[model samples]
Target: MFVAAIVGLLVSMLFALVRAFLGPTIYDTILSVNVFGTKTVLLIAVFGFLMGRPDFLDIALVYALINFVGVVAVARLAQSLLRDKVAMLIACVCDSQWDC
Candidate 1:
């Protein structure tokens, strides 16, 4: 059963990876990456249990935290970049004499 769970997690991770590559928008890709990270955490936890090592849970927890922080940071960076682009477009339109 544990092996089955690990296989399932691996399959789910594979699907997430595919979606990340084929996602229609940046947000969708980000979401898929996040999902992949989450499944990785689960995989680690399960494998730790199967191996009788409690220490793996700690590693999994740390990984989860890092994943959460990394995703948030990336999302904030993307939003700021989008905002900058909009501001640039507004400035360009305002500077132009002809109506856009």
Candidate 2:
């Protein structure tokens, strides 16, 4: 059972990687990377159980936290860049107009 789960997780991780590489938009790629990180955590947990090493769970938890923080940071950066571009566009439009 554990081996099967491990294999399934590996397969899912591969699919996520493919999506990450070929996603149409930045958001899609981000989502796929997040999914891949999640699957990695799951794989670590399952592998730990199969090997009877509970310490691996702690490593998995840490990895999960890092993954979450990384995703949030990237999302915020993307949003900030997008907002800046929009603001710049609006400023350009306002500057071109005669009236405020």
Candidate number of the best TM-score: 2
lDDT value, candidate 1, whole model: 0.93
Q: Distance (Å) between predicted and true CA of 16, model 1?
A: 0.5
1-100 per-residue lDDT for model 2 (tens digits): 9999999999999999999999998888989989999999999999999999989999899999999899999989999989999999998998889456
Per-candidate TM-scores read 0.82, 0.84
For residue 41, model 2's alpha carbon misses the true position, in angstroms, by 0.5
RMSD in order of candidates: 2.2, 2.4
* CA lDDT for candidate 2: 0.94
lDDT of each: 0.93, 0.94
Report model 1's TM-score to 2 decimal places: 0.82
**Residue 88 alpha-carbon offset, candidate 1, angstroms:** 3.6
Model 2 Cα displacement at 92 (Å)? 5.8
